[model samples]
Target: MALPTFTQRYEAGDAWLANSCAHPTLVQDVWAADMLAPIPSGEEWLVAEARLATGYPKLVRIRAEQRGPVLADPVMDALWWLVPLGAAEELADVRQLVVQAAGWCLNCPPTGWQVEGRMWITRPDGSGLLTDPAVLAAAFGPGGYRLATEASR
Candidate 1:
């Protein structure tokens, strides 16, 4: 079979949320503004779908099913009410905790998977402390693969 396109993943994730039949909240609206973006065509949609599939909520239950106990984050308890059974396996415990503690900072509704912190969004990749490639190289590492020495701080 052909590999599923990004829109397919996004639509799938969207269906998962829609199947839950939960109403969007004020927080969700704001978070959505910060968190979600239009699919921007096929490739972007696929990127988003992949992120959602591997992110906190998705990773949580998936870990629970394949690995063990879901770490149990308070935030997830709130978010879980909105998720469908189909995507339950992907949620990660720690990620839920982060979302619980910091997810609110998201400027948009939760739509796609994200791999960075809220600060990363507020500041963005090519601005503020993240402006310099060397700074990023040191903070995150070479080719964004390694962390830097203490002097960087």
Candidate 2:
């Protein structure tokens, strides 16, 4: 299948996130300024955070799922993936993955947008897509085949 272009992804992300929050206008405004806006996790989805060192490889190994949304903060050396609601616990065992469920907020930017060292490495495609925690863990699990292959690359 053909992937969505940046414009498509941007529209999808903007529309989806605008509706996800209580104040749509505020979210829009924040994004217009190229600033990170806080998005609450739990009710809709959870966030799986990992160090750039670990998360980048896993994301590369997975080839970036159509529904998988990922964000990166260069300044923080952190990468975040949006996972299904209640799936945070599933990725808890992955050494560097931090599962942020209810009561946690993720700072996010518009799809295809970067601001203050934060960028959307992968944006939400607006197809109700989310990373599968099980798959993420398996791909990054110790001694996994992908690691050996990726290491040699």
Candidate 3:
């Protein structure tokens, strides 16, 4: 269940501006370190898939059974979205679309991995956001953005 389209997702409130007011300063800080890069002109911007995930509930997990860079503390903050009624059940579907779309944008095949108690059933290599509701649900827990290193198994 890939997202119908970026347009469709946004229209349905699934597209949150990467730097919108809805995101807290902490979230922005985390996003900056974990998911954004600077354009040639020196302006910073969230990666394409990250931009998409901002509006939609998504996750981005790096798998390969190896940890890469050390994520800065502020960069690991969690951003949680409220799930309105009738939308809770669609978590898996939303995640699938987000994952597929991200994989396409990143020019890679979908890769699945487990994290904590939940599973990052779909993911990419470099940096991208997963859009499934279930993934989001797990990622943004009571505290938010559980460290990949400390995420439950």
Top-TM-score structure, candidate number: 2
User: How do the predictions measure up, each by TM-score?
Assistant: 0.25, 0.85, 0.19
Kindly list the per-residue Cα lDDT of model 2 for residues 1-153, writing each as its tens digit: 998787987888778866667777888898888788887877677888899876787687775542388889977989988888877667777777888857588888887768888887878777768888777887678754254457789
How high a TM-score does candidate 3 get? 0.19
Error of 2 at 121 (Å): 1.0
| lDDT, candidate 1, 1-153, per-residue tens | 997665665445444332222333443453455553211211111111122222333333221212211112233332111221222223332222221221122222233434223111111111111112222112222222232342376
What local lDDT score does residue 121 receive in model 1, on the 0 to 100 scale? 14
Q: How accurate is candidate 2 locally (lDDT)?
A: 0.78
What are the RMSD figures for all models against the true structure? 15.7, 3.2, 16.1
The 0-to-1 C-alpha lDDT of every candidate, in the order given, reads 0.26, 0.78, 0.29
Q: Cα deviation of 32 in candidate 3 (Å)?
A: 27
Q: What TM-score should be assigned to candidate 2? A: 0.85
Evaluate model 1: give its lDDT. Answer: 0.26
